[model samples]
Target: MVFLPSLPAHMQRRAPSRRLGVWLWALALCLCLFGEGAPAWAADGEGDITLSSRYWIDASGVQSVDEVAAQPAGTLVEMDGFRSFSLGSSALWMRLDLPRLDPSQRWFLLLSAAAFTNEVDLYQRGADGGWIRQRAGDHLPVAQWDHPDQTPVFAIDAKVQGPVWLRVMNSPTPTSPRLQLLTENSLQTKRYWTFLMVGGYLGFGLLVLFLGWVHARLYGDRAFVAYCFYVAFMLGFQAAFTGIGGLFFWDQSARWNDMAPAVFMLWLTASGIWFVREVCAVSRHHRGVDRFVIAWSVFGLLYPLLYVNLQTPAAFAVLNLYGLLSVLLSVALCLWTWRLGEAYSGWLVLGFLPVHLGYPFPALRSAGVLPDSWAMQYAVLIGSAIEIPLLLYILHRRAKDFNENRARLRALESTDPLTGLTIPLVLTLRLRDALRRSRRYGHRCGMVLVELANHAEIVDREGREAGDRALVVAASRLSAVVRDVDTVCRVSDTRFAMLIEGPQRPEQLKLLAQHVVARGLERVPTLPVELTLRFRLVSATLPESGDSSEAANDDERLMERLHRALDRLASEPRRVVLHLPVRMPAGA
Candidate 1:
């Protein structure tokens, strides 16, 4: 502290205790009248003033101006950075001194912390050396507001510039508030930028939400659906609770401005819980916990309606408590899911941690338990916005993996693993469909039973592995030669069948059989030791071999006739095919 000049040598040396008391009284008077935050001193001088930079705070719960003024100056503390100070259920007295301004100039004091404060009082010194008062607050009617916008702006008579004292009181909590001094034109610019910011945030949220909705449409997945609800709830709660809705959409709705946060928060909690349930696959994996989550989520949606008109301190406290508890439960759920081996739960955990960890910051800052900072105010927004895209990407990856895996599973059931041929089940179904089509359309559908005549001999001679390899090669060769419309499958280890449908007459069928025989000879069978795979390819028209006794279905009849044909082929000299009535080689 800068001190006054020392007393003269004789005056200082005499009556030490009396001198000490006199000096102390003088110091006390000086601090009271000219201390850093003394209203008599102008806190700001010159061009433009950011009133938050200079403030004197009294966390005194006193509401009367006279009472607060009577308090000793030592009780008031100077603010260091922002006009932010937390005093629960009390008022903060702030003083801003502006240097003299010419009569031609005008100034506006902008109060941007409208959402957090319920009432604010502005007092400016008049020519008569007395403070003149003006009132502004959210609780007041729109007509009573000092300015015509979402946030409050009070006009300053620059010609009467000196010092101004504002009594900020009756907020939900103690907070360091934001205040800006500007010319009328600058205030307009600030409003414009604020408008753009709010609009941009909402726009970006909607675009992502549309993407989530698209995902739900394409895949019909519960996670995507839940995510859409989650984002909606989050965005709604942010809009209402942050007072953006009042500024942009509901400025005239005083009741809505008051109740919007609690009401929207109710839905937000429920949606967040439900989203956790779906994204974490809680119902499928954690049956016991799932019931609790569902019950709580359902209750949360209805709880706000139950207490719709209940606006008390206790009510607000209870709602905040429930919100915090919900976050804890969700956090725990994520941790449990992560621990239980859900790999994607890592994304869920990190995605949700910000809201959980950040909830307290806003609560603390609002209640004057902590000072407001950008980090505390926007932590959840930054975190959740980041999580939205990352989580969606994770969901996309999961869905893709799910579809690919399902296809592989179906393949396993329908194909011959050893030779990569369609198995009996699939082939049977295809044949039945072919028969139905043939009967309806009166079109010819041919069944070709191509039997590996020397397959057993080769298996016994060259070992089963070689025989299997030869069957694989034969299946590949046959499949390659057939048109895409044809179906090929192995009914037995050594015998295969092909369903051929198209514009093919009897002569054309003969040519197709010959082509198959030629192709089958392309790769020598494994037993030829040099591979000995040899086959007589026979073709039969559908329903031609339907003379059946015990077979209950057309599919069975086809298989039965093919087996009988194979038996005939096995008994023959392997020179001619019985159905085709043709010979292949001169040597045999």
Candidate 2:
């Protein structure tokens, strides 16, 4: 093989295109780097001395304050936080030269970093030219720290004529240190904004949980239940990973402070998998992806046990990579579900993409792949906070879809396709409910079960299709004759039932039945054979057929009485259109 850059003969014309693509890519990269929202550099009198260009690093990290101070100023190489390195086990000392300013000028040295650093020592020259030392970091509990609520911030006395010496002994990662000199106003503004973001993150989580719980109760949707668990577990994981759990929640319990991050992440992954399973109904569309999600959840649930015991740097990086892997898997699963055209897939794809992309920034920062910055440290939380509103909208859509689907399923189960009427089981339930309502509210309810006369004769002479047409016509007339409060249903090929809600007398019921039979007989559909079709209407009114407690509660007895009335009418086939009067049983 030749070791020269060459393109194949088929791609010779594409060389210019390839170079153009590279230039476009370079331009896009420049825009991404320079178009971001990083704070501007503050000059000495602008806000405070930024120390961005004023600081020099000692890579060996072994020199004493006096020994380093003894060297020529030219010996030190200037670097900003963006140009720092991995000082493994060795403490890096950063020296900053301060200029004497007016008495009104007050400067605070602020190190904006995660609170995981073990040791931070700040040495300043006192009035007598001796070193005055100040300590801060997680090595001491919050109560004992110089500034508890913040990352290491120290007050620098401007009386010193020499440089300010700072030493950081921390993890063996390539952390780009963030150091800033802030005026009192700038310092307070930073604290105010930080506190506001933390509070907003917490409040957003609680609001999502509360709304999810209420919707879950209202609709009883499994997706909503998954959403509640996902939000709760996600908040727990964020509280831990963002250092809020250690500093605020578990300050008294050292083991809890150490293990909360991994434990909550495990549970968050579990709940996240379950949430995806519910929203997408993954088993219905993609069983293979569903199985993988299940396996991933199980692994995540068990991984935290190992994390509690292995607290080293390697273990920490592995755990963070695990989280990144989980997010990647989730994104793939959602994309697969969307490809399968699952319902509500848009909600999942749109609501989860931001957080999934943002998850890696914090993870890569933890794994030492990226430098320490506000985006790496806090973007995950911020992105997830934005996801709350998107997810809530998705949740609302999911719940509404669930309820509509449930109602449609119920209708399919209990409705007759031919006549579009309630079927046997559902009609019976409606009758029982009507009986209870009639008793409870002291209202009257009536039912009429009509069986067609000459229906069998027409089928026997012509065909079953002819009888079906007659039944359809009779059903239409029966429906037209009943009031809107009445329900009409096809019980059998020749029988149609109507439940009427009216407090009319017995004669009125008979009159209504007569009108139904007459109209039904008038509109019999023509068959191939030249013949006439007839129908009979027999109705039963509550408290008129049987007054016993058994008839009131027993659905079978009520149906039996209507069938008996129909049987009585069947004997008189000579009658063209029969309408039976209300008759009480023997017990009543």
Candidate 3:
């Protein structure tokens, strides 16, 4: 077979069209790269480009950064994102020997740092041939020998006129020995765009926080609380990353930047996973699959340290692939859940696409494979914005499901199977909760114990079915007369409990109980229904100290005291006794 650059015959003839297509793509890429908010920088012979620094291979041909201390001080150089191979030694450093530009010319200096040895320091070459500190506040603090991979950064700043030389120190044992410099472009026109982009992100983030807080209050949902916490972590981390934390908060602690990103990503991921799981009710269906989805999140959670230690382009690519895989898996799980008719799963599926597409764009751009621009950064932000609404939708659906399930479960547990009256178990638990709340908040709560007179005799004389009907009727009448906050429960075969909230006084509790009993009897009908019953009202005052835990304890004690008071009130021969409020431990 003969080797050919282009395909033979028809393919060769199509080469022109292929070239045209490639030119169109190139044109599109150019528009994307230079369309707006970008500083037009031509690559003049003097090399200045994007620059960031990490420990460089140093003196002893090892990766140890300590060796940089022993080498002749050199300058670190970098190029734009278009340049590749940021980790190895720069091929050459092109020195700019221009006479100092007029400092008042609104000039900006763009020094491209391909890579720094362990640390880079700026010094001025004195006329006496000694290197003196430039004192320009340009030196970044040294990082741990273990540094993350960041592309060579071009730190932009106002031009400084001096005989300046950047001192690049390598680890004592660098495997490569070299520095690179790339063409610097004037950025005077691009400053406004940069300010706007940064300002927009900050303002948008703040607005999201404010709106989320307001939405939380309006909805009164606990999930929003979690959402707020998650957003707080993310916004705080982003602010810290952009150097605003240093500028506005503290300048010396660069360590926060180093550590916070990893921590924030983990916390945010966990919170997001938990919120999704709750919304989807993953625990209710296919617990194993839910657990697997949860387990998969650990990959992102664990990858941060790897990212920190290996800030190489290859590491970035690996991470991008890993993130994409996780997103795909999540999408699959969400779709499966949706197919099974789960309500919140649709939101998860909708949210996944943007997050899946958006997260990897940064890695691609950082790797020089995708054009870096304001639009690209905003695309990620826009995708994140889309995700927020999906989460809110999920929360709303979850709240609806929660309310429905709560009503169903309450009915199942509390209502008597045959009579539809409140069962003892359900009413007791509800009463306990209200009492606990009342004690904690200094709210008034009262209880009435009711006994159906001669229930066993009625059941014996009437068939079991008739007895059950009577109980059902009594329950319906009791429910109609009492307020929604009040609970009526059949504590035993013949005994019932009614809990109410109102002013904390013995007379008021007795009156309320008497009214309920009187109204209930009137509803029973006068002809054939004898329906005699007795009730005792017990009232108590919650402590003003308002300690919920202490209040819980006090509620338990009050309940015990009420039982005692009931025992004494029952001593009366003919009628039911309405016990008066008995003051106990005021502190309790």
lDDT of the candidates, in the order given: 0.66, 0.68, 0.50
**Of 2 and 3, which scores higher on lDDT?**
2
* Candidate 3 segments whose C-alpha is farther than 4 A from its true place: 1-81, 88-103, 110-229, 259-271, 302-318, 376-378, 408-588
For model 1, the superposed segments whose C-alpha errors exceed 4 Å read 1-77, 80-89, 101-106, 125-136, 141-144, 298-325, 353-360, 404-443, 452-477, 514-536, 542-558, 572-588
- Indicate the residue-level lDDT of 438 in model 3: 67
Q: Name the candidate that leads on TM-score.
A: 1
lDDT of 1 by residue, 1-588 (tens): 112233335434542445334544553453344322212212243222443334455556655655555567666655565435544566777767655655564677766556666677787767897777777766664456666565667778887856676777644444566666666666666567556755676788899899999988988788888889888888877776555777667777776665666677788888888988887778877688899999989888887875556545566676777787887778777667756655565556545543554567676665556654444445455445555665677788766777788888889888888887888888888888887776566565777888776677667877978777778888887798678988999987777898887544567677777877777666563445455457676676654333222232256755676677667766678454555422112222
For 438-474, candidate 2 gives per-residue lDDT tens digits of 6666656778888877788888987988777777777
Q: Give the winner by TM-score: 1 or 3.
A: 1
Task: Give each model a TM-score.
Answer: 0.74, 0.73, 0.47
Q: After superposition, how far is residue 559 of candidate 3 from its true place, in Å?
A: 31
Q: Count residue pairs with overlapping backbones in model 3.
A: 35
